[model samples]
Target: MFHVFCLGFLCCSMVFGILLPVYESYKAVKTKDVRQYLRWMMYWIVFGLFMCAETFTDIFLGFWFPFYYEIKVAAVFWLLSPTTKGSSFLYRKFVHPAFEKREPEIDEMISQTKERGYNTIVNFGSRSVAYATQVILQTAVKCLKT
Candidate 1:
């Protein structure tokens, strides 16, 4: 019974999350209006964060809380609600400020990570080629001997 209720709430959240965004996105494209685009951007950022949190917490608290899905769906609705404009409020009050403060640090970390990843991939590629060449040469020598 609890699982069934959770499923229903999940379906409702999906409908709100997917359908409403697509509709708003189409309007944004058709109108080519900056405000509409900004509104959707705010919605996406909050919704995305909510999804990441839900994914991590659901395993631990999903079944424990009876109101979990109910709250999840409600939160999604709040984020997308035009009258409430919860997303914009949250972004302005919290998300934007936090990100703005950390932007430089984040940029530096990202650059370092990218450089490390590139170096690792290059090292792996060179090592793989060398190993392959060694195997090929050894096989050729063995075949020639036989």
Candidate 2:
């Protein structure tokens, strides 16, 4: 029924949006052409943002929009179309400009996150080792008593 259409739409989107683009990106990388590589990199950045937005839209508004899948498929096709260069257009118009404006703030946030993540991991590791040692010691003592 409706679910079948959604599944088909997603499959088509995946083929055009992800799989084919990935192959093209690989070829672009192998050729060592900066222009082609940059083009595909733009596509990847735009596609990533598209996916994040789509996840929320699909969760909140998908059922309400009867033509959702069709529109999604068309959008993916547009993004991948060489003639349109939609991905490049979007990156230049939106993503690049926004990121450029916020790059410093973004970098600061990333640096703080990395520091916190490292500290958290170190803390977790030490706690885990301590717990394991305690458990082992307790088990050994119990076994010896028996």
Candidate 3:
């Protein structure tokens, strides 16, 4: 019984994860349609995040509760169905708003970091090399004394 369920799950995952995406990618390439490609890309990214959240939810809440499986089924259906607009809802309500609010702050931080990051990395690398060389020379000196 468990094996049957596992097999079915594997099949479904393979179809959805590999076959469908490959088909869509081929279509996107053949048609040279940027919108179609972007739409699918956005859908997958949203769905991937949704799946991650769902996994954590299942781990924390699923074992103690009944009807979790049913809820997951419904949730998957909602996410996959274009009419439900689950991906769009998630992006507009959560992803877009959060990024929009932080965009200026994020851009400023990136610019500031870019200015300092090269010098920081060079300083750190040179310090690390100097320390390593000092340790090696000290070890060699100790070996000579012994």
Question: Candidates 1 and 3: which is better by lDDT?
Answer: 1
Q: Which scores higher on TM-score, 1 or 2?
A: 2
Candidate 2 vs candidate 3: the TM-score winner is 2
Enumerate clash totals for all models, in the order shown.
0, 0, 0
The lDDT per prediction is 0.89, 0.93, 0.72
**Ranking of candidates on lDDT, top first:** 2, 1, 3
CA RMSD (A), model 1: 1.6
Backbone collision tally, model 2: 0
Candidate 1's residue-wise lDDT over 1-146, tens digit each? 88887788778877898787989888997999999999998888888888898898899988897688788888888888899999999999999999999999999999999999999999999999999999999999999999
Score candidate 3 by TM-score against the native: 0.61
TM-score of each: 0.90, 0.95, 0.61
Model 1: CA > 4 A from native: none
- Candidate 2: where is the Cα deviation over 4 Å? none
Q: Pick the candidate with the highest TM-score.
A: 2
lDDT of 1: 0.89
What global local distance difference test value does model 3 have?
0.72
Candidate 2 per-residue lDDT, tens place, 18-124, comes to 99999999999999989999899999999999999999999987889878888989999888899999999999999999999999999999999999999999999
Question: Can you write out model 3's per-residue Cα lDDT over 76-114, one digit (the tens) per residue?
Answer: 556555688675677778877887899999999999999
- Model 1, position 105, has a per-residue lDDT of 100
